[model samples]
Target: METIRYGPEPSQLAELTRPSGRPKGVVVVIHGGFWRSRYDLSLGRPLAASLAAEGWAAWNVEYRRVGNGGGWPGTFDDIAAAIDALADVDDLDTGSVLTLGHSAGGHLAVWAAGRARLAGPPWGRPRVAVTGAVSQAGVLDLAAAHDANLGTGAVQDFMGGSRDDRYRLADPAAMIPLDVPVRCIHGTEDDVVPLSQSTGYVERAVRAGADAELTEVAGDHFVLIDPASAAWARTLQILTALG
Candidate 1:
């Protein structure tokens, strides 16, 4: 595992793990902590390592979260920079990059994939081209999350405001019909992020003519990120199928 810095800030770092032999592709892992500073990139280390062992170059990225110089546009900016930084890496297959995010990270992953259409002063344009994305129990629908007050109003806190233009621009559901294929996997028993988030988003994406699908598993939220969990194995299968 090699720690690479995408920006000067400590939060703008990613752990890169190369496969034992030639990598099949690159997998960008994004951790979920409800977009808070209390949670760091460590949550994604296990998944990155697992992907590396499976012959895929995994890049586990970290970004500024709420309460750590992160809110609204800052958090978005950090994610954009971290993903785009992949262009600087060597010997990695940039053409076939896939992003996997859990929880709030799942939101960012889908959002990052659709950054090309984001409109606002803060969101310019993302240079990284994501070929595919997987959201594991992702908080994909910001408006619904805000209404339901998931994570004690985490959506409001991350957006730094209520449902407004900024919230709409940052929302993965609102930015649907992304060019790439999106697969949303959620545990039916997930209490943290409900199944509606995945189903709702995929419904909208399909209506918008995007290639989106929802896969339901039998587990909870954390199981999606646990390397030893059956959910994790299913996730691996999904990633393998992405090729």
Candidate 2:
């Protein structure tokens, strides 16, 4: 594994891992911490290493979170810069790029894939297009998260507001019909994020004519990211199918 910088800030970095032989593609792993400083990229290191061992180049990205130089546009900006930086990586197939994010990272993964649809001066264009995305126990629906008060007002803290526009911009559910294929996997017993977040987003995405679907697994929130768990096996199955 090698650490590479995508921007000036220390948080704007990613850990790159290459397999023994030619890789199928690159997988961008985004960690979950409810978009807070307390949780860093450490949560994603294990997953990145595992992907590398499975013959995939894994770019585990770290971005500024709430309490740091993150929140709102800053967090969004960091994610955009980190994913785009992969274009500069040598000997890698960016055309087959995929994003796998857990929890809050899941929201960003799906959001980043749909960035091309955003209006204005293109806040940030990914140099390498994202072909597909997987959200593992993600808070996909910002409005639902805010309404349920997940993480004790985490949605408001991350978005910096409770306005409708704020929710619309940050909510992955609202940004449905993304061009790329998106799969959301959630644990049936996940109390932290809830299965509804994934199911709700998939429902909306399908209704909007997006290639989206939801898979329900057994276990709680952490099991989805735990390598030894059945939930993780299901995740790997989905990822391998993508390839």
Candidate 3:
């Protein structure tokens, strides 16, 4: 219900609420726009409002767009700052964190939780430990995405630079080794990010000893955010199971 701004200027956190008398947990929803400055984070408001009505406090977060170095430290830093801000808000349950992101956001969602696993990343472990993740059409493999040239140069901008960045924070395929609880929902008909992203994720997660499930649904990239679509139903079910 209240929009909160945290971190440095230009860097902000946007949120929506529905006042569910008592919240069961906090769900941080990351908006996907290939991390560009033009897209803004307001689009995810509907998703956050929906989750808030379902007895969950939804924190819709935004960070700086891809920096000259691709949005490295800055993007990552903003994510950590926004999640930590939830602690100051009353009724938030720090122990439970359910992060959901679509497309580019998905990559950040998983990365935020497993940042500590990054061999030599400057930032330390994140405080926003994920209880579960519902990634919809996420870019799980940067190497794959880069090869496919997803989101045009938008993804590349978010990533900052080359393969080194992919290894450090871009590739979820490599980070899956930490084995966090993740649920990937992809539209069987999706063309943007494709079901392959989730499929590859399912394979890697299982191989890495993490708990992961891949569920197929009907529709395309946009349907995942459309409440009327089957993709939304799958998302609800996934979060329900996690909660």
State which candidate has the highest lDDT: 1
Residues 36-126 of candidate 1: C-alpha lDDT, one tens digit per residue: 9999999999999899999999999999999888878888888888888999998776888898999999999898888877664345565
What is the per-residue lDDT of model 3 for residues 1-102, given as tens digits with 9 covering 90 to 100? Answer: 787888546657667574558776778888887777765677678788778777777888878876422275677777777877776776566687888888
Better of 2 and 3 by lDDT: 2
lDDT of each: 0.89, 0.88, 0.75
* Per-residue lDDT of candidate 2, residues 71-165 (tens digit): 98899888888888998888888878889999999999899888777775445446778889999999898888988889999988988877577
**Ranking of models by lDDT:** 1, 2, 3
C-alpha TM-scores of all predictions = 0.96, 0.97, 0.91
List runs of model 1 lying over 4 Å from the truth: 119-124
Q: For candidate 2, what is the TM-score? A: 0.97
Predictions ranked by TM-score, top down?
Answer: 2, 1, 3
Quote the positional error of residue 177 for candidate 2 in Å. 0.5
For model 2, the superposed segments whose C-alpha errors exceed 4 Å read 120-124
For model 1, what is the alpha-carbon lDDT of residue 114?
A: 82
**Worst 10-residue stretch by lDDT in candidate 1?**
118-127
- How far does residue 183 in candidate 1 sit from its true spot (Å)? 0.4
